[model samples]
Every structure is written in C-alpha cells, then in structure tokens.
Target chain A: MTISFTDAKSLNHDQLEEGTAFAPRFDAHGLITVVTLEDGSNDVLMVAHMNAETLSLTLESGIAHYWSRSRKAIWKKGETSGEMQEVIELRTDCDQDCLVMVVRQTGRGAACHTGRKSCFYRKVIMTDGTASLEDTGLPRLFDPEAVYGG
Target chain B: MTISFTDAKSLNHDQLEEGTAFAPRFDAHGLITVVTLEDGSNDVLMVAHMNAETLSLTLESGIAHYWSRSRKAIWKKGETSGEMQEVIELRTDCDQDCLVMVVRQTGRGAACHTGRKSCFYRKVIMTDGTASLEDTGLPRLFDPEAVYGG
Candidate 1:
C-alpha cells in the first residue's frame, strides 16, 4: 500500500506548519530536497532529492531511496556499494518542502559514493578575494576505485 | 569585489570532484541547494537555496544569505527577526552542487520563521500506510506575532 500525503493546498498556513497533517509541497518538478544526517554524531551525510514515489518507498521500506536527477530513476542508496542507510528518524520542515533524515549509515559508514564518511569533506576558503576549496583532512574510508571498479 | 566561481563546465569529473577548485554547479534556475546546521549541536536548522550572488554575499559577509523563492529576492536571514545566522564554517559536497553551512543562530536562537530553533520541528510517522506528522516538542524561542507582527 502506498502512503498518501495530505494536500498542502487544502490547508491554511498555520495548519500546514503547526498541524498533524503531512502535506509536502513538492517543487515544480515534483521533487523535495532531503538532507541526510548521521544518527549519533548529527553529521550531515549527503543532500539529495526525492520524488513522491521514492519518498513513499523510503517510508515503507525504512531504507533511503532518492531520485537521481541525472539518471531520472529511483536510486536505492548504498544498494550497489553495500552501504545502505537505515532510517532512524525522518523529519519535515515548517513548510514541508524539505526533509531531514537521521539514519544509521551501514557498511563502512561511508555516505559519499567517493568513499568519504560524509559528502562534505572540503571547506570553502577565501584567499585574496578568490574562493578555493580545501580538503578537511578527512581520509577516504574505502578506496572508491576498488569498490566501484571504475 | 564580487567573488567569481570557476566554471563547472571546464572541469572534468576527477577535477570537479577530487580537485581543490570551488566550482559550484548551479541549477538551471541559477541556484544551489544549501543545508544549514547549528555549529556545536550539529542540528540541521534549515534547508534553503542560494543563487550565485547570495552565495558570494554569504561567503564575503560571513552571514547567511539565501534566495527567497517566495519573495524573489535575497534574504539575509535574521535581518528582520533579529535571528541572524553567523556562519561558522562552510563546506561543499564532492560535486560542489550542494553546501553545508555551520552557523551560530543568533537572536533568541530561532532559525525558522515560526520562531523555532530549527525549521524542522516535527517528525514524520507512518501508521497503517497513512503518514502523519508529530511535533518534536521544540518550543518557540520567540513569539512570531510579536517578532514579525501579525
């Protein structure tokens, strides 16, 4: 059975924000942004998008599923890499256009396809009015070439 | 001086993902997704978007600035509600299409327009194939009516 969401258009602002209804206001592309966080450390794992079908799949299965804009298909995260994410808690924002998912990252605890613990492994810095990215010293948890076999 | 970004088109996959250049891949709308987290607690405060100008503004000013889709303008967060966010650190993902900002939420510590500490103040639960939202019990740090004036 597919989980159904309330119609966000039918609710008033106060009801949408403060009520018990789970009406997600998807963007024009029928996608909602989702930020995934590691359960215990609260570290942001990755940011991705989800269509309604994938969202429902995630809720029903307790595994993280996302819509790949590039692939234009449903992506069951960590499926190929043996790093499945087990949902701990799922949250929606005030307007319900976005989501915060707390999950236990399985496998080697790598969330990024690049074998990084978290996707955000580099910090942005300004040097002489020019912006550059600096590695945050987070070593790769696994070798991507060996795992993905590129 | 307006900060310029490296053209993402010029970079190859390895250069884009594994290199040190800070080339952000903005969407067709000229915006990039951003996830903001509370500095110490690592709690996600909000998810928003940043156009190139606002992204530059944020990096230069060390304050949070977002493209307000509803308002169709740059939103210097906490400018009106006295809840301005001072950026602590800024990190981008492997692809640089998304950003994670560590910030200190100022002025009563509210990050949501609803006067909550974080925009995500509710949890999603599925019961019998029906999804419902449950309050996470995060109290308002300030009164919205008094702060924004109803």
Candidate 2:
C-alpha cells in the first residue's frame, strides 16, 4: 500500500506550526533531513535523509530507513551490517522541514559506518585563528572491514 | 579578517573522515546542516544551516550563527529576541557534512522562534494507517508577540 502525506503547500503558517497536521515540507530533492539519536543515552547517532517512501517504510515497520544520497537509492539501514535501529519516537520540527528520530540501537550498538556508536565523534577546536578537530576518544564498537568487507 | 577552511577538495576519503582536518563539505548551496542541542537537558533546540561566513562567525564569537534560508542572510541568533545561544561545543560528523552544536540557551532559556525551549515540541504519531502529531506538553517560555512585536 502506498502512504501519502498531507500537502504542506495548503497549510498556513499557524496551521503548519501549531496544528496537528503532518505536512512535511520536503526540499527540492524530495528529501527531508533526519537526525537520529540513541534512545537511552540520547546521543546523536547519525544524521541522514529520507524520501517519502523511506519515511513511510520507517513509520510502517518501526525501523529506520533512509535515502542514501551517494547511492541514489533507498537504504534500509543495517541491511548490510547488523546495526539496525528500532524507532522509539519520531518528531518533526516546527516548520516540518526536518525530523528527529529516537531509536534503540541494535546489534553491536554501532550507528556509524566507521564502526563508532556515533558519527559525531570529533569536536571542533579553534586556537590562534585556526580551527581543527580533536577526537572525543570514543572507541569503535565494531570493525567496519569485517562487517562491510571492503 | 577573513577566515578560511582547509578546502575539502584537497582531502582524500581517509583524510576527510578520519583525519583531524576541519574540512566541512558544504552542499551545492554553499551551506551545511547544523543541529543545535541544549547543553544540560540535551534536547534538540533547532535545525539550521550555516555557510562559511556564519560558520566562521560562530567559531569566532563562541555564539551560534546560522544562514537564514528565508531571509537569505546571516542570522545572529537571539539578536532580536534576546535568546542568544552560547555554543559550548561544536562537533562534526565522520564525513564532515553535518554539524552538532551544544549550546547554553540564554535570556529566557528559549531556543525557538515560537518561544518554546525547543522547536521539536511535537511528536509524530502513526496510528493504524494514518499519521498525525501530538504535542509534548512543553510550555512556551516567552510570548512571541511581546518579544517580536507583531
């Protein structure tokens, strides 16, 4: 069955922001940004994008699905690896241009392709007019090579 | 003085993903996605965009700056409402295409234009075959009309 969303074009500012309608304003690429966070820790695991189909699949199956920009296809996350995410809660921002998803990380609890629990493992540091990065010392939970196989 | 970044074009995959270089990969529109979170509660405040100029300004001032897509200009957040955000930490994803900022919401302790502590005040509810939204019961910390002046 095909699922559809309320047309955001028809909603006024107040209705869109304050009302209960689920009209997501997809960007020109037919995608909306999604920020995924681990449910227990509330740590941001990854940031990804989803098209209407993946969004429906996510809501229907209670699993996280995303649109891989580089691959130009629907990505059932953890299909290749064993890091599936169980959706606990899904939220939309006021303007409905972005989404926040709380999920329970399955398998080895890794949420990044680099085998880390979170994609955001490095903090930006600015010193003497130059900016660099410092690792937060988050250790990898799994081996990407063994899981993804080059 | 103009701040510059280590051009992402010069970085290889390993250098960009695993190295310490702060090479942010801006999208085709010369903007990168930013996710802001409250420092203590860790609730997502808002999702925004940042160009090189706003990115530099944010780092230089230790305050949050964003690219206002609607206004087509640099937005010094809280400039109008006194809810300025003092960035506590800035982080980049493994691919450097997205950013996470931990901030202390000043003034009225609100981080949303709607006068709420968070822009993500509603949760998406999928029941049966339909989807809608349910408010999270987060009360507005300030009045928009009195602050912004209708």
Candidate 3:
C-alpha cells in the first residue's frame, strides 16, 4: 500500500508533538519545500518543492521527486539529465512544513541543469557600494548543451 | 555605502547569465528563502527568510539575521536563545533568488527554538497504512521555557 499524510490543520499539539505520524503541512499552493543534500559529503545539492503526489512517489520509489511550480508538474529528478538522487534518509522539521532529504546522487552526480555539482555555484561580493556575484569556479561535470540540446 | 540589487524583471538572459551584478528576484512578498547549515557538520539547521534589510545586515555584520514573517520583525538569531550563528560563508543560487549560509553556531550550538541542536528533530514513518513522525531522539541542548521565559 502507498503511504499517506495526516492533515496538519486537524491535528492537536499532543498528537503532533508526540505521535509518530507523517503530517505534512502543505501551503495553499499544495506544495512543501524540500532541501536535498549529498549524503556522504553532506553538501547541499538543490532546493525544490513537492506536492503530495511527488512526496508519495519519492517515499515509494526511494528516489527524489519534486513539484515544478514553474512548469506546474511533477519532476522525477534525473529523468532527463540522468542525475537521480537515491534517498538515504528523509527528515521533517518541527511543524513538518519543510523536508530535508539525504541522498546518494547517481549518474553524473551533478544536480544542477547547468551540470554543476550544486545549483549554488556563486558567492556574493560587495565592492565599492555594489553587490555582485563571483563564481566559485566549480567545474561542470557534464555538458548541458550536449545533454539537453541548445 | 549600502549595497543594492538590480530589479530582476529588467534583466535578460545575457544580463542574468553573464553579468556579475546581483539581482535577487524576491517573490511578491518581498522575501527570499535562506537556508542555514552548520559549517563543519553541514547539517541543515533551519530554513528561514530574509527581507532586504536583514539580508544586508547579515552581509555587513557577518551574523546570521532573518525576517520573522509571523512576528513581522527583524530577528537576530540567538538574541533571545543565545544560539547566534556566525556566518562563515554566504552563497546564492544560480539565479540569485535563494541563499545558503554556512555558519558556526554559537552558545549551545542549538539552532531551534525547540531547544534542539537543529530544528529538524523528527522523521516520518509510514507503516500499515498509517503515517506519523518518529522523534530522531536528538537531545535537547537547552530548556526552551528557561531560555525564553515561561
């Protein structure tokens, strides 16, 4: 049988605080934020969102799935880029509004569509009263143009 | 002089892709997401938001600051709980709308108001068509009532 979540709004503090139930609180948009991290290294890979369907799929398949608000669809990570994330552990915060997933990234080990190991490839720099971005110089593991086509 | 960001709406692919300028595209709420992780352990401590003022304060002071959307105020983390986060590095995502901060958590090393080392203290459980939260059993580093005053 597939897993399901409890309605957070209907649960009491005692039930929420002490009960061992998966009660995820989705926003009005029917989405919850999920942060993915590379397991061994604990490096953040990407930050995305998940709808109930995607969340259930991730739990059932042991793979990472996300809700693409931009495309308004469910995205099976690495379905096209071959960079799948195998879930090692999934944890929820106090209110269960956010999720953190520890996973072993398969294939190219790149999480960003740009082929970088991480989506965050730059740092902010303040110079002469201006703020700018400076590349961290992380090398791309794959050629995006070759994989996704320009 | 105070640093400012360019309006993301006015920038094109070339300007956004190749330019060094920092143009954070805040959502309609005038807020951007910020995730905090412990510097050495790399465990995610908390996920919060930043308004322009708090973001600038974090950049200028090297202290992690956040916007409390519920309280509608600027919060200097650890001010009440003594769990200040000293920024070791600050990074922005490829598009500059999200941020990740690696910090050295001060005082008791707890980042959660729940008195836990990290805010994520539970994992979801799915068994026999039932779903619930299982406490990760991370010890409470402090007493919330004592720190915040009951």
Q: Tell me, by TM-score, which candidate is best.
A: 2
- What TM-score against the true chain A does chain A of each candidate get? 0.97, 0.98, 0.94
- Error (Å) of candidate 3 at residue B77 is 0.9
lDDT of 1 by residue, B1-150 (tens): 799999999999999998989999999999999999999999999999999999999999999999998999999998899999999999999988999999998889999999899999999998888999999999998999998896
Task: Report the error of model 3 at residue A144, Å.
Answer: 0.9
Per-prediction tally of clashes = 0, 0, 7
Q: For residues B29-142, what per-residue lDDT tens digits would candidate 2 score against the true structure?
A: 999999999997778999999999999999999999999999999999999999999999999999999999999999999888899999999999977789999999989999
lDDT ranking from best candidate downward:
1, 2, 3
Query: Fraction of true inter-chain Cα contacts (below 8 Å) kept per model?
Result: 0.94, 0.71, 0.76
TM-score of each: 0.98, 0.98, 0.95
- Tell me the tens digit of each residue's lDDT in model 3 across A1-150: 567778887789757655666788898899998889999888888899999999999988889999998899889999999999999889998777889999999998899888999988887887766778888887899998899997
Tens digit per residue, CA lDDT, model 3, B1-150: 455778877888657754677887787789998889999898999999998888888888889989998899999999998899999888887767788899999999899888898878898666665656779998999988799976
TM-score, candidate number 1:
0.98
List the candidate 3 regions with Cα displacement exceeding 4 Å. none
Query: Can you tell me which runs of candidate 1 are displaced by over 4 Å?
Result: none
TM-score of predicted structure 2:
0.98
